[model samples]
Target: MAFVLTSILGNDEAIKILSYKWIWSEEFLNKIPLYLLDDLLRHYNRSTMEEHKLLEILAIIKKDFQKSSENERFRD
Candidate 1:
């Protein structure tokens, strides 16, 4: 789902859609690239969702980022 959205809308726009619509599940969220997640977090203050939900999403994004970074380091 994230892949399709990213392909069709590009990362920035996809993130905007996801953030605004609150349409992302954990699996979908995990599918988004870490860079896009970072972009989302950077602009989170501009989103309309409740602060706690946004913080929860940020935690998931951070966890995914750490896991991806660890995997890359392990592969290297």
Candidate 2:
């Protein structure tokens, strides 16, 4: 968790880590907390350019988070 959390530090570090090569995957993305994930997305949305691959990865992660929250909502 701390390892993943480190990605959130500093301005645009999240975008750099996420947009660069091979630093992330679906399994790795799932390990990140939703709040931190949202924060990462904020940084990404603010700073990233035209990295299509990173956009796709982030979209999938966001969709999964939405699905999980929906499932939890129904369960409660």
Highest-TM-score candidate: 1
For model 1, residues 1-76, the per-residue Cα lDDT tens digits are 3543465469986565445322435664566567556755565446543555445655554565444532232221
Query: How does residue 58 of candidate 1 score in lDDT?
Result: 50
Superposition TM-score, candidate 1 onto the true structure: 0.32
Count backbone overlaps in model 2: 0
Q: Per-residue lDDT tens digits of candidate 2, residues 42-76?
A: 55556553455345555554565444432232221
lDDT of each: 0.51, 0.46
Candidate 2 has its poorest 10 consecutive residues by lDDT at 67-76
Query: What's the true lDDT of residue 13 in model 2?
Result: 50
Q: Specify the highest-lDDT model's number.
A: 1
